[model samples]
Target: MSDLIDDPREGANEPEFTVSEISTAVKRTIEGTFDHVRIRGEVGRVVHARSGHLYFDIKDDRSVLGCTAWKGQVARLSVMPEEGMEIIATGRLTTFPNQSKYQMNVQDVAVAGEGALMAMLEKRKKKLAAEGLFDPARKQQIPFLPEVIGVITSPTGAVIRDILHRLRDRFPRKVLIWPVAVQGERCAPEVTRAIDGFNAFTAGGALPRPDLIIVARGGGSIEDLWGFNEESVARAAAASGIPLISAVGHETDTTLIDFASDLRAPTPTAAAELAVPVRAELLARLEEIESRRISAMRTALNYRGEKLRDLSRALPRVDALTAGAQQRLDLAAARLPGALTARVDRGRAALSEASGALRPSLLARTINSARERSEDRGKRLAPALERSSAAAQGDLARITKRFDTLSLAPQIDRRNDALAQLMRRFKQATEVAHSQRARKLDALDRLRLTLGYKATLERGFAVVRSAKGEVLTSTKLAKAHAVLDIEFADGTLSIGAKKTARPSASVSKKGTQGSLF
Candidate 1:
């Protein structure tokens, strides 16, 4: 057995170990070799976990190295790692015995160089451009004079002081400062949140909403000004309800936020100048306008006064125009009595001539001659009257006999038949009118059913109403915390209204379509 076992030293050279033991040995070797390192590579899939740990992969053309930045170390990183960004990560290598894996525990990270920074920026720019956030139509017009201007920057930095001083020189306005980190890992998130916070205020609340926003920073390199190029900052700026002014770096330093903003300023001071008009210039303009207005009014008054004088000279005197009519009236009054006397004398002469022709003695002689002739005629007519009376009695007796021969029963029967036929026709017309009225009533009933609201309710549609029962047809009218009742065909649902957010251009279009439905 001793010979078969061989030398213990020989056996020790070829060691037999359990899985854990082998893993531990390998971990020590790797960790000891790479105790501290500074590696440069392009970042791959970066995952920020809820536990505040960041896990990512750093890869060159040949191979990839797994990396991790713990919560504390991640907070200290100068540059937040993004996928496809080439960065230099400085940390110590470590191993996980459980999974038999080794990784770099990144303690610090920085952009590899200006070329990498520019590459990353160009990639982000393309993504935002595809979303149309940089469209000219989406940009807002900055107010000439904002009531409350919100400024986002590092409060202690010279940038803020410059902006404030410039604004003071131009026009004094109410400024609300939102202090944020101007660079480093905290910059992007802080800037994004500040923009959202400013927009979240109620328009007329105790803390009034800003009418315009200015995001300013002093001149710096691309890396120092990387926060403005962040996607979150760009989207936030694009989604701002208030018009935004981006002044990130010097005139040549353009960032993603500049495209999304309503206006871009070369410098922080220039941004302030754009926010308001110069006080002296505005006052001078108003004074000029007032002088012009007064001059115009004076000219108008002079023209009107001259016109009134010309009109008065052109008008004829009322008394002079009526003199001829007054004279004619006086002449007619002078001839009135003589004209009446001549007309009365003519009437009296005509009556005297008629009276002479009808004298009483001449009328009495004519009446005596006519009476004698009438008495002779009456004596001759009495004999003829007695002869005619006998013939008339005979004719009357013949006519009475003919009337008795004719029967009246047949005529009475014919009249009764005609009356029955007329009654039957009248009854038919009454029945026809009743049928027509009934048909019209039925048609009217069908029309009423078709036009009723019940028909519309049967369709798959609902009406949303507020607690006060007012219909909510617009998202703007839906207030936070208000109870909304959705009335369906079968039932109704009541829910609390959700707080509305600033919608992007695409989201706004979708919302408009939904409201129409």
Candidate 2:
């Protein structure tokens, strides 16, 4: 229902129109005054009419208004609209007759303040480039096999959903979410806080450091998307130890954060695609590479095979050269056995001839020599016996003559002379025999001393014999309770052996000597 304004000066003089008339007139006045009216708002309850018309609400913090756009106008949008899309609509105001409502007939619809966003983004890009943040030198490479990935984005937003979906599909890895407001006045600080928090968390060893960071959000109006353009956000991204990939807006949209980041991607999903390689496409490429590698290997193998075949063909010549050597060997091999047999036969024949020729003559000569030696010995023995008999007879005759003469001349004087001569001869014979017997006795005494065991002990030494009759020189040979016979010059004495004392304890100095003997 519409209410009419009251006039204070002429309350009764004014004529009252119907609510519809007032609303229609008002709508007409507004449409006529403004050639184009543009209003910015967030899209809500958006509905596409079947009649090629789109109906939605333009809303802000204070108010909401109805809006409609023809399909022709909607076609110009680079993106599809869902709830909470910020947009600017330029159209004339109109009123619905049946519903009695004011609504906008949008001639043109576009994202609001994108020019400002672009201009700011370009300026920031230049600024960051000057600061070397946007320079390629500052960009870090994302690890192909990262253990963990850090995501700086809205806790509950479509961007996260897209990212998780892509990451799960491409490659599943640990993802740590540092939730932050992505679109608001509080978004910059939250984003900066998240970057710092992630860095701190990694530094404290509570979490593994991120190999890559994804700073992303869904598409929005320039104002809603302004958080990514903040200097703090850019610096945070630039200073993040990890490599950063910025994904903020639709494919056609670009932001200052994108420039500052190591890599820029148009959309959250595209960013995910960039972060990880597609498994199917990568496998296909690997297979292609493997195929090419195998082809190269086969080509190399074939070349080597051809070279081997050429070498194999030349082997016959080598074999022919070797054949001459084989022939010489064969000739040697054939002649060796016959030559050996002939040499053996010759040796045997020579040995047989020598044996045959030497045996009879050697026997005959040996027999003749034996006979001649026997006859010569017989002749010598006969002559020696005859000369020995003659010498015996002459000695007997001389003895007889001396005896006879002595008998005849002997009287008292003769007897006395003979007796003196005999005495002198007897004395000389006794002296000579006594001398020879003394020498013999001395030789026999030396022999007896050498053979006697008592001879060793007679020289101021003791012969210590063990019970087993072995000579015990060392005390180690006689244990405790062992009976040993100590043979000295006078007698043999038996004593029981005792354990030998240790060297250190048994030893004494000159002045500190004790009697133990």
Candidate 3:
């Protein structure tokens, strides 16, 4: 009885415990008290860990509470945590024994209200806008008529059915459906992949590539349609090689993809309408154009025919034009003989008058006197002619002897020998020049063989080039997960470079060694 009384006060006072023991007790109590609780606060200091876990702080105007979502729970989260976003996090509160603090292990997270969702959306819009995804220059022009239209949406949803029905009503088109989750964690990645896949197809292949893509989904709350606002989906839309039409929701519903797309449709049906023109309207336009062309051609032909008829009426007859000329020729021919006879008679009369003016007796006397004078002059010139001939002969003989004394044959021979010597020297110089040029050409050929890129390829060395055809001599210019082309002597090989988890230490070491070498 004495021991029980002594120990009652002592046992109560001696109930002290170690730090770990007290922490364990507190952890259990807090975890049990806050099990399956929902907390509403604005998110702050969000951190996505490399392990796929999320760490964040949830705070009101009064105080803050640390929160954590494991990788598995994060996958199920409807809204990813962002700073200053009001959200409702559902989980259990637990204590960290090591740090002596308590936090919530979040099982799921969602936007608290419409206001919070809009605020988050606006924030994302600003971020994407800064990256130039919403630039007008980035937008493509929608094709007037697409041969194949790629549709990205849930196949079972009303959005696809509406789009197809509208297309059938207006103009039937070939549609390739890429069914994807429209409102979940899978939505963003599936849509992004669909856009990229459509672009990757080779044009004019067996499965013809789509000329236009329509990403459609029905109207929903901001949270339900949040996938369209994902950065990946927006960027994929912006970078699409094929023109894209964004029909994410109703006219009032807008998403980030709309800004990046080539055209934004108010509804799925409207997107189809924008894709192609009505067949009946097109046929009517073609018929009108054909009628106008036929009318113009007929008018032109009629004008030409009328002009030809007028020209024929204005033309003169060929026989009538030549009759006057023929008459003039006949008159000239008839008077030609008479005119010639008159001219001959006039010439004979003039000649007879001139003959009658002279006398034959006077002419005979003058001739007799002229003959006697000619005989006297001949006798006087004979002796002088003989003397002049003798002197000329002597001068000719002396000139002949002088020519024989100074002969040109030997001088001609000497000149020919000098010319031959010069010809031989010229030949030697030409041969020397030809040999020098040949040696220089041989040296140039050797230099080309040693310095040319083809020679390097022949030595089993390859040139690495990027997709843009720029030569890549170092890793700095090479992009991770990018394709590269290697040029060899035989052919070219295409390959992809994977990003290394850690940079190699040997890179720097080799660079130093290369510098030394």
Candidate 4:
């Protein structure tokens, strides 16, 4: 109906255009004029679009400004705008023609001031704490004496110097300095990388991996030390494989990394002190302990010697102890000769009394009586044997006649057929058992191949072995062997080291090996 009605004043002296044309012109004009600008405002409603775009309103008491950050730009934002948070947005301003609105296309974002930064820091701290990053259970105990200490800090700063000096004064140890920016924009990422780089090292490699890591920075304002407050830096500290000691800023100045680290130091100098004890003091204490041990040992020996002397004094003399046994032995010796003589006389008298019973005539009579009895028994046994043989022969002759009379061919044939049938069944059962065992053997072979490490060698991996055919699991162990066998997918490689001296199993040394086996 509105399209049908025509205006009477269609042609006028003033210039005119369509709504789209005017909007396009306005869009171009506004974008050209305010191509780049920074706007500081308090964040209002924020919308994280499903398409990875961030839409939000920045408003003050009077007016509101619309801001948007696309997916590509959102990741680069130092501070992601949150509700009720103040932020300074840096981007180009452009108007939307269709919607008849103007919006700021945010390229970067940051907290407006220290207050906002503190607010963000507090919020992040709460979030990370809720995730248990700061839990005491996750904190690792510091090594009593770390052989290698990795220091992460700026190379040009006196903080690292102070740490090294303090470490030198206390203890001498290997220090791996990972130079990184300790302040400003590059600080967080560089520090994080330093931590990860230290952790990536393999033990006993060409470069010795650190037993402990120290992240350090000098004292400064919150803004100067903001890098340690970054979430990435804190998470890196928490996730460090090596135990990390955070020594950033002064004692009173706490950062997020301090909470996530295994230990916190008041200053960079203090971190070194925590790493190890003073060498001179340790030596002195050891000497004192050794002195105490020697003194105690001497005291024990003296006490034992006194007790032994007292016991010896209380003991009877050797001659006194043997006197009673010697007297008794002498008494027995005096009676032994007379007793032996009496025994001999009694034996002679007994022999004389029994001499008459062993005469020649008496022996001859006894032999004749035994011979007569033996001859009678032999005659009776021969007759019994003859009668039993005759009876056996008669029975055998009778059974032979009965066997000849019966037909035995059919029973013999039946027995043969049954035997053949049993043989056939046994053969079939043997075949079935053999087949089952063969299948099981094949399955076992496949399982062995699957479980073996050779198949995995094709995937850019190799199995390292010592010359003694042992699988070397660690670099230190591999280095211990002069010859290494590296098995790849295609073949095996045997390589020799510069110095190939295989250690002997015999622990025997001249006066050094212990007496106990």
* Top model number, TM-score: 4
* Model 3 lDDT, residue 195, Cα: 97
lDDT of 2 by residue, 152-200 (tens): 8887877898899999999777899988888765688888888877766
- Give the TM-scores of the predictions, in the order they appear: 0.59, 0.43, 0.59, 0.64
Q: Any idea what lDDT model 4 has?
A: 0.90
Q: Model 3, range 201-282, lDDT digits (tens) per residue?
A: 9987888899999999999988789999988899999999999999998999999999989999999989999999998999
The worst-scoring run of ten residues by lDDT in candidate 2 lies at: 508-517
Worst 10 residues of 4 by lDDT: 508-517
TM-score, model 3 to reference: 0.59
Using TM-score, rank the candidates from best to worst: 4, 1, 3, 2
Candidate 4 error regions (>4 Å): 1-11, 130-132, 174-179, 193-210, 239-241, 311-317, 359-517
lDDT of 4 by residue, 131-243 (tens): 99999999999999999999999999999899899899999899999999988767888999999999999998999999999999999999889889998899999999899
Candidate 1: where is the Cα deviation over 4 Å?
1-9, 12-15, 45-54, 70-80, 310-313, 325-517
Error of 1 at 505 (Å): 99
Sort the predicted structures by lDDT, highest score first. Answer: 4, 3, 1, 2
Q: Give the whole-model CA lDDT for all candidates, comma-separated.
A: 0.89, 0.79, 0.90, 0.90
11 Cα displacement, candidate 4 (Å): 7.2
Report the lDDT tens digits of candidate 1 across residue range 49-95: 99999999999999999999999998788778889999999998988
